[model samples]
Target: MSRTLNLGILAHVDAGKTSLTERLLHTAGVIDELGSVDAGNTQTDSLALERQRGITIKSAVASFVVDDVVVNLIDTPGHPDFIAEVERVLDVLDGAVLVVSAVEGVQAQTRVLMRTLRRLEIPTVVFVNKMDRRGADGQRVARDVVEKLETDAPIYFGSAITGVGVDDLVAGVTSSLPSIDPVDGPLAGTVFKVERGRAGEKVALVRLFSGTVRVRDRVKIGDSAGKVTAIAVFEGGAAPRRATARAGQIAKLWGLDVRIGDTIGVAHRDRVRHFAPPTLETVVESHDRVALHAALEQLAEQDPLINLRLDGDDIVVSLYGEVQKEVLETTLALEYGVAVTFRETRTVRVERPQGVGEAVRFIGENPYAATIGLRVEPGPAVFRLEVELGSLPRAFFTATEEAVRGTLRADRVHDCTVTMTHSGYSSPVSVAGDFRGLAPIVLREALRRAGTATCEPMHRFRLEIPADVLTAVLAALSKVGGVPLTTTATVLEGFVPAARVHELRRRLPSLTRGEGVLESEFDHYA
Candidate 1:
């Protein structure tokens, strides 16, 4: 067996994350020549849009050997808009290399990634890149990291471009970070990423935690089952053919239509938690509606969390910020050759149940062919389902439970995933067909009677500014309906609606003459 380590490279936009990846691979002799992000020739950034924009729109993986250990390196997008891509990849990482630009110091996205790394308890080594640039102060940046990120991370000063501290950074990774033993269990893995092969066959990038997976092995992803026809292991900037992949390794498996966050194997792990939900939504318009819909369906298969839905003649998409919107537009035209337009972004509305209520629909009602009795009430879980086992046959319980959980994501009230105490049915007779069809109507009525209200997600923010600018910052926060939780000479902590995050982020820099620092994370919904 080979010793292995899985790690990720994370940072803010243009902070030299891809640069660091290129330099590391070159130094390890994994690649023959160095590739530069500015020249659009980096090995990991193979996408055309990435080259055009000089930003990583998707996460890419590469592998190299260090000190007899096969190290799998995941380079993640640095933009806040694509943070979801980073969140999904977090499950596979044993540790991470957080790159901070010595010239720019600690940034908002840097702070966000640090908070997540800490929350996940993934050990990290901070690398201060771009030290050769004028005004680059590795010491000041290290101090900022400790102060803003609140982490006692071991910091290494170096420039990924100049190879000043590249060797030291590699040594730190191999020596300082301990290896993670594979969890003992059956063949269980999480599908963190997915893509389509050249032949249009579905390929799932899975992080296997236990058991050995070989070609032709039968694997189960959620309720779907398929036999793996091929396997690819990330090595030396390429995914080469592999016969088998064991626990603690990341591999690509074919023949399974697995979505991101799907559990492949016995026990299931919850989807990686994200601090903020998408607050912006846009309607997709295209001259060729049919082709555009098909294109979106394909995109949805790649990133299931986007939750792309079709509404009659229109298709609506959830967005993190403006960058995502631009990327989607460019990708559609570039990848699928589908020219599309988008409507002005609108705030995505979520629904919450106000009180308790129940609804019943029997056979021969409207177009229904089954009976469903559901009682819905507000509670903690996103959508909890309970059934009276005595009322239904044991054989049908499994199917019914799956259907209920599937429908929980979308309720009729506001088309949002609603939190509820319970939505259940009791029947002495088993329905002829699946209850999934009837459950939606019953659930919708129950939620309607429960008194649904539109709710928006909220965020808690911290702003650091000059002492003299504190009063102006307070006024700006007040204008955005922010409630301050704490106020000091130069810092203000408060909670505000997520809808106003972009405004605060945009205005603060101008208000404080580019000296203000703002950090925000999801708090709750209001």
Candidate 2:
């Protein structure tokens, strides 16, 4: 049986992720030429802004056949601001290749990505890349992966430039990666990314998990069941061709109003899973106010994670991390002819009432009444609010739940649980919708209210510096807001005390002074 592998190239920003992607495509013979990230000539970073900035602003897909096996490579943005792009792509991938710079080992964003991968339970292979660079210690970096990432990730040391160990790495991936086991029989797929055609239409890049789809094959997407009129094959930086794609293959499908994170298939729409989109939000800065909305709208269509809004005078756009924010600014200036400015990023906060509350009713200008009797209290941080229809018609439960979720989204509480309950005719009941905003206050005053806060993400950093510079390192960490969790001493013959996992972060750069090694993981929130 022929198999298709959906793999992602992930790493920290400037870890040579785009460079490695170019090399892989060139080696695989997918491209006749190789593009350099520094030169801004890479196939994936084809946008004008990307070429000028020398970084990947969005996820790009390209396919190649190696040894009769078709490999679909998704090159994702390594910067944190584009993390929403990363998170959205991860859901459709069967596996990922985590590229780590041998010289830098692991950085802050790497820890965040690894934690996300673990949470998704995706199998991964770690690529210790850039062995060609001076001071590139693959073995030491491999050890750091084990200790800091807390993974037994089998390492494949290689140089993307020289192709050394590339073959071995390929063999390991082909042999160990898991095959897709689709629950919704035959030909279901999910849209990982989307972009607008130069002519102003939407183009969806989809990954098929099972079954087969051919050009001109009618397909439905998401709960809306929108039909796809055409299928286009994409080979990077070119117009798509009419083609048929099977399970595990990535194809560019046209003629559908499909959004990113939408699932496409024949009877497989219900089984498709959506990944968590980007959380950070920001606003666009432009020299001219007239072009700001148009630019922001175009960007939002390209990547849905960047939730765009007009919050008074500022044009607001949400981002996953700082890197994404920078890319947005660059793109606005270069692509849209707008000089964009951004506010400091704020974490997406969730609020719920602390105690029990009664039903609150609000009468708007219309005759309709908005009544909600919610008992707001803290539940598990990550539990799905499942809707259960008991005696009410199943259709009613589904409709009501959809309405509740829609309300939540419109109210700007995209990350909340809501369920429909119908045990012995409960009037088509709709449960939790963690609504935010002032309207919730009117509801809370009439009912009940409570609140709890969970910060974005924290990491545990470990630095291995010369024994003589330990104190200086520790002191530096204090300056950068590093909290010292723990310290340990290594009993070597002549070396200074080696710290284990816990310590301050600011100290590492000063302690190492270009000599010591530092590592960290996603530690729990404060």
Candidate 3:
């Protein structure tokens, strides 16, 4: 049996990543011929709109065997609009191939992808694609990649269309890239993505890192449990039921109602997510208000980061950018048959705890009949019980946890650690409801003491324009509250409110006579 290597192929728009995926599949003899992105016949670009637009909108998975390794190639969208999809796939990749255009040199999204890959420490191979194009400059682009990426990644030159240098890429995957060995340890996995069955049942896409999942086994699904009715392993596009899915394999498991980021059997070993959550929100309007919310809930099940909720009478959905907003509208209309319009989008302002804080409320002493003490600190996002688990009735503990989750669910600010430092009860007077009611108040007071700093979402931008338009661009930046971190002769890098990005994009063309190119990504809240 061949070992498995979960690999991700990533690139910016038109970087030829989909073409490279075709070449890799064909090289492995998975397909008889190559598929073109423009022709819309590529195996991976399966969505209708994807074919119409000639770009990938969803992450596609295909399998091939290369050098005793079952290479599970996950093709991710290069467009900045669908970056949330790419971020979801990144959590499961053992390694990645970052495709760069030899002609375009290094792009803004390329820099973003590389920066994230490096930060995650996922072993990467940079493929300098479009080597056969007119302005292809492999040597210069190689230097540029080195300077911009600051990566020691093994670089290969290739034209995905012409199939040159694919052999070297193949060799690099086995030699330079990393792979994990299967283990027979305890069952451990993570639900990275979720899909719906024909009957609308939840089908979970789980990456098993160890042990085995067989039919009818009641296994842990995050904090809940579910019986595995069936299991199917990925065979390129087809998913046929299998007896069991073992370690070091990806499987589609049925009969599990799960959400993204939920762990199966054991704790997930992957690091905390590196991608920022959506910072923009829009109010959705639909003729059938009832059907609209129900459909939105179904869509949210697949990508929970979209954050579907109701604001008074209007339904609101969170999104990453304008592109995501458009995609959400299209998916709802095409898949869910829920056609809707959206109001103006706005930034999602959030409050973050400024420092370590502790607050306690005791029965009789406070307005509540429960005693709960909590400590909040600026750290990794986690909820821990510093107090013994058995101290309170299981229901009271559960209620306390629910209170914490609800309070933090809408917080888009930086992560903070919550710890239950103390807990007590006056016997019958301390009902589960008492703790649940007091937990939030105590936590809020702790947050207040820690200092509530409201922050608006900000985008880190890089602007390149001609020197002649420097004054005009600088003046334009000032109007939008752009603060340049570094200003060069023609390049300006800075942070601006996300709401100003669209306005800046519109002004760039006239400001630089259509020569100015601006690239920005959500950096942080301030």
Candidate 4:
């Protein structure tokens, strides 16, 4: 059996990471020539604005063979603005190549990425690119990388443009990095990317850990089920249009309504959301509200974090910050052709169930042909089925539970497990759509009975400052709703409102006389 390695190449902006990707592909005979970012001809940076800006925005995939193993190369965006896209792809990688610039050394985003990689324990190989350019200091840059990122891995210095030291890098990846031997087991695959085909069908880019998925196979995709109408394995041909996607392979599968971070077969791995969820919201208005809404629906399907919704007369979009806002506007105008304007941004408060409550609706009594009994209470599991699993058709159960979670997510609630207290359906009259449509109503009724406590989502923050300025830093943190939990010498740690983290980061420099360093990530709600 052939082995495979799902490798990711990640870096901060302008580190020649994309150039390194093009070089790797060309060296492996995957492409005829190196595609230039400046020429707008790179293989991975496909977006129009991405090409214009000479930076990657979307994660791209290509396969290359080395010895007996097939290496699946994932080119992720280097920009902080597209960190969501990058974050979505990180879990799919078996190993990663962290690209650092020889001249610029380790950057802010580079440190962030390095921390995440270390936290995840993803085996990483650091590559120092642009060694051929003037002002490039490989030794000093290597020291900086060690000092900043604190990684003990070997760093390869190479000029991506000149193809020098790249062969060594490839050798390091093949030898030092892990290549998993595919094992036999129940079908377990992860959906890493979801794209709309030309015919508007969802195309799932899946990384299969075990078992095989062939054409026309009915598969369970997390909470949903669908037939695999077509398959294109990434191992062979310029594009393998139809083939069986087997274990240890990546493939483009059609005929599935799935999302990124979804398990395609059995649960391969639980996708942990580490980044702070978007709580900043703004209103979008257009001349054609219907068209604008339709476009946003499509966009939101691709990125669930957007949290697009109807807020009375306005359409609200939840996002991270200004850069994401600009990207959304650009995507709307360029792809959907819907010109729009945004209203004042505001903090979106989240809620948690304060008490336990149950509500039940019978089949004949309910307007819909499905009966759903829901119990809302404070817990960890987001959605749990208390009743027998086979009480209803799997499709109906999936739909109802999916709807329950959707409604809760739309309402911006945290840490509440909704249980299916009871479920019933009319034999001939009932359908999955009926249960899906009724679920939200029953869930909301139970939530109302339980009541809730609105909370401001917070971030776990760590600040390093000079010992002399600790007092001043502590005072500054208090101004931004920061709760300092602990102090170790000059290091302060605590939780702050997620929305105000950026504000604290902005104020840290002034508070500590430019000697303050702060790092924060979403922690919990208070």
Best of the candidates, TM-score? 1
Candidate 1's displacement at residue 244, Å, is 1.3
Clashing pairs in 1: none
Residue 485, candidate 2: Cα error in Å is 6.3
Positional deviation of 365 in candidate 4, in angstroms? 10
- Superposition TM-score, candidate 4 onto the true structure: 0.84
Model 3 accuracy (lDDT, Cα): 0.86
Candidate 4 stretches greater than 4 Å from native: 132-137, 147-150, 180-187, 216-225, 235-237, 355-377, 381-406, 417-451, 466-468, 488-490, 509-515
lDDT of 2 by residue, 205-254 (tens): 88777777776666767556555566776433233576676666677777
TM-score of each: 0.91, 0.74, 0.86, 0.84
Candidate 2 minimal-lDDT segment of 10 residues: 490-499
lDDT of 4 at 182: 77
**Mind sharing the TM-score for model 1?**
0.91
As a TM-score, model 3 comes out at 0.86
lDDT tens digits, residue span 1-526, model 1: 4667899999999899999999999999999898989899998898999998999989998989886677889999999889888988898888999999999999988988898899988999999999999999978988898888899988998888889999999999988886656566789888888899999888999888788888999988787888999999876557888998788888999988777888888764566475576777889999998988898989987766566876666788888888899999999998899999999988777777788778777665635445566776776544434545555555445554455555555432333333222223435444534466666666778777888788877888988899999888889899998999999989899899888888988898889999898888776677
Query: Looking at model 1, how many pairs of residues clash?
Result: 0
Superposed model 1: Cα runs more than 4 Å off: 180-185, 268-270, 382-390, 393-408, 411-434
